[model samples]
Target: MQIVTEKLLNLGVDEDKEINESQLVLLDVKEDEKSEWKALSLNKQLSDARAELFVLLNGVEDKEIQDKIIFNYKALQKFRKKENDKELIVEKEVQIQTHERGDVTIYCDGGCTPNPGKAGSGIAVYRNDKLSELWYGLYEEMGTNNTAELGALYESLLLAKKESENGNTVEIKCDSMYSINCIKTWAISWEKKGWTKKGGEIKNLEIIKLSYHLYNSIKKDITLSHIKAHAGFEGNELADRMTMYTIQEKSESFVKYDKEIIVVDILKMRA
Candidate 1:
């Protein structure tokens, strides 16, 4: 309840008028029965009012303010669950697909605001063309877009290795050709020359090295390819959104996106 109230207040809903407005959104109540939706806006009752607002917004739609509140409420709930578990809780569908699916695809991306400011990485995983998992994090206080892209690619490699180990074919789609080349093409030559490039010192060499080794180990079962960014690919778009979310949330560690918490409209395809 405290979490709900804090989020609401943070989102600019700190007033008695706002509380009454949200309380009245309760659908379909007679004049007398509607009193049950009495506003709890007193200093002593503000907490209850905020908590009830969370519940009231559950099925309400199309109102911008209410939508934001509901979305924040769900996100906070998922964050709390993750904190309590101390582990990424794999969805039942993902767990069951281990042996049932033979193919998996992962789309990943990363970027920083102002080119070298706060950065984040995002990844979207699919099993037989269906979204199975979403992950975002790797928050860098001060980092370049390239570094963030490399971080996202490295994380995808980690996921790819796991899928390959499960006897599943994996394909990683990244929007950065620079990232794909660094691990798949350039790394081979760099490895032969003691990780040196005559041009200059390699940027993000540490992550490149880690990703290169992991990719080699899973190369037989995995393929890393480049896909154009913002080309209307649902998975890629979702991954990009996840990356932006990391910046908005300032999460330093990778967090699993709980679809049940809020619907990702971009992931839904149009016929």
Candidate 2:
């Protein structure tokens, strides 16, 4: 998904050297100041780019690479447009309070059917290894698995903060390594870089930033771990099941799962 920018075409621009060669360039100035090279409205430009790329390659043969390229290109467009300004004003903030002397574990998951449709997130919370609460929702008509995963993780962080305030040490388990890395690993560097990445635009930056903020605020009492999905981890399996419940029921808000949890029955519910 490499693009040709003005710096690549021009002779001298030391600063442009830092830009990745494979970066997606939405627009660049033409030879004259008043003219532009490939300017179009963001959506129209992106549609054309995707069409041209797929045509060049003959078809969408490699889905992973195709998804990555399109995801980063769209992210770059959002970055350029400063589209998340209103979204950055998050209403929720972590508050520090005295602890209550308990321990809790939270398992969270998210998924989408058909890759880009009917996405939702789910969470299973346990107190001292005993099932205590279940949560699911954040439904989207058209959303990626990554967004759903991040949404679940963000909600888990909120619950973890609450548990931490209750004097409990909290552990959060998630199967998506990408989401975990975005919050616990890469976010530190991304924050320092003003939320821009040298490799490309940061995908899901808004939620990642919010999750990172909440995680850091309560990190002293909370631990985040990555686990294998559908590998006989009961909590993870339960959380995974929760994701489907919302999509099945067409729920949009992040709400509690009030039904009783018979492990085998709940597992079979999804089957």
Candidate 3:
């Protein structure tokens, strides 16, 4: 508990203030009566509580602290379920046509406003000459720019895997050399070394592993290319805009995909 508290302090959170505030909000929730719990108000409370929980969850490395955080998270999840609130849930899987023709290109970007502050990730997918999908979401807690960038790459590959058939080429464009090299080169050595580099623990190991697996799972010609960020590339520019929009507005999980035309909705993740 002390370690987790210190970690939260290092992340610029006032422990007493934040926890007290969250407790007050949780206490206000009417657990028995659904009629008194307005959707909007309950959502705001859940979001705030989740945000605090994420900060604590992300900051700590100890399993004990993680278990404590998960306990709190489960309580929040239970309350949210009782209220039938689905706004904060995110879809973990998506289905798309596997035989779509032509090449698919994905542009991805991610960053935090203050680099180590609230972070977000965005991706834009183009099939042949038409835009196919757009996705962006805010990180629940504070995170580094690289974490968000790696998340973008991971999500892009995940989408490509779901949307493309075998033998179809998929191109991923991003500006982060660190993220690009991690999957393309560094990850191999890291895995051989038990997920380490220079005998030191690797940062963003979870996302890096996820990205590596997703990259390898695609049985197609997958190309990762670096583009000059903030330059005039159309897809890159839109991805950047979407990333910034998420960070600035703290956008919820949003996904828009082309089905005949573009369709978007707030989705929930399946357990």
Candidate 4:
């Protein structure tokens, strides 16, 4: 029977007794016989896999291969739900409530023109309501917006992971939901697929890989979220500003300090 390509890949099929998406499931199959499984219609195949996908057809369909997957449909739905979950509103240099616990916040962003052309990145941190530190770099040549964004995020998180002398928990934030999702869920597959979606020319492979490594460096669970762009959000606005700062070579605005405390605002997006 046909299975969703993603589902097949995710289930690690063929590892041992692995077969299909539904193979590892404990679902009480309506049928137990292999013949019954073979005779099942296609929808049941997805259902068996416990896929969160939905029907996308113009008419009531029948064939197993009639529908196309809405890539990232589940991720977007989950993202929207998270956005509505009491708004993890991360603000700028707003003294974190975690100072007593000694945890700091990090923000990162990046950009480039003609994508594979000139690139730039920025990283900032806040502690106890002040700009504890900032990092900005320029890519006179090479890379794209997505690459630069991943670069900025990776370097920033690296800084946070390194600064934790006591092995304190740190939080890193960014506005690119795709970046967050890819790092959290798709990094391995992307790596195995050569950083390309289907083993093609992965535009941002290097930086994406770097970001993945940085994410894994955290001793505690990582948290990432999307911040509204151009909605007068301070943390996001600064992240954008920091990114443009590198591209424009205006490196004077960034700061550096020790000791910080504030809710992490993961703000960064490219226009």
Off by more than 4 A, model 2: 1-101
Candidate 1 Cα deviation (angstroms), residue 34: 52
Model 2 weakest lDDT span, ten residues long: 18-27
Task: Give per-residue CA lDDT, model 2, range 1-271, as digits (tens).
Answer: 3344343323222333321212223233333432333242122323345434433332334557656766776778668545443332231222223323477899999999969999999999887788877788889999989999999999999888877777788899999999999988899988898988898888888999999999889888889999999999889999998999978866666777767777788789677
Off by over 4 Å in 3: 1-95, 98-100, 249-254, 257-271
Ordered list by lDDT, greatest first: 1, 2, 3, 4
**Residue range 19-53, candidate 3, lDDT tens digits:** 22333233244445433333323324234454466
- Which residue pairs collide in model 1, if any? none
**lDDT for 53 (candidate 4):** 35
User: Which candidate, 2 or 3, has the higher lDDT?
Assistant: 2
Model 2 earns a TM-score of 0.63
- For 136-208, candidate 1 gives per-residue lDDT tens digits of 8888889888999999998888778777777788899999999989988999999999999998998899999
User: Please, what is the whole-model Cα lDDT of each candidate in the order they appear?
Assistant: 0.73, 0.73, 0.65, 0.54
lDDT of 3 at 34: 32
Candidates in order, TM-scores: namely: 0.63, 0.63, 0.62, 0.49
Look at candidate 3 and tell me the lDDT of residue 54. 48
